[model samples]
Target: MSSKSINISEEAYERLNSWKKSNDESFTDVIIRVLPQKRNLSEILECLEPIDEETAEEMKKAIDDEDSA
Candidate 1:
């Protein structure tokens, strides 16, 4: 496969280097591993478990107090 040259800032290079799983890992691999995957809102919502009523009320009260402040 042919590879193309791309330019990146020193800071960006350093950040990508830091994400390398090992010295043998390539920049392409690091990018693939670190990048976020696209997910639908329903998929994201499905991951969340429902909280109990008491805990829910406490959280609501905390928000109300923060809003009042």
Candidate 2:
């Protein structure tokens, strides 16, 4: 496969290097492993489990208390 060279700041290089599992891992591999996956709101919402009425009430109460404070 063909490759390209790009420049990064020293800080960026250090930060990326810190994520390497071992000297065997490449910068490209670290980036692909660490980057966040794109997900729509609906996709994210689908993963959430439903809360019980009691837990929901407690959360609402906590929010109300914080608002009052």
Candidate No. with top lDDT = 2
Shift of residue 19 alpha carbon in model 1, Å: 1.1
- List the candidate 2 regions with Cα displacement exceeding 4 Å: 1-4, 54-69
What pairs collide in candidate 1? Answer: none
lDDT of 2 by residue, 8-46 (tens): 999999999999999999988898899978999999999
Task: Quote model 2's TM-score.
Answer: 0.62
What are the clashing pairs of model 2? none
TM-score of each: 0.57, 0.62
| Model 1 per-residue lDDT tens digits across residues 1-69 | 788899999999999999998999999988878897899999999999999999999999999999999
Candidate 1's TM-score: 0.57
In terms of TM-score, which candidate is strongest?
A: 2
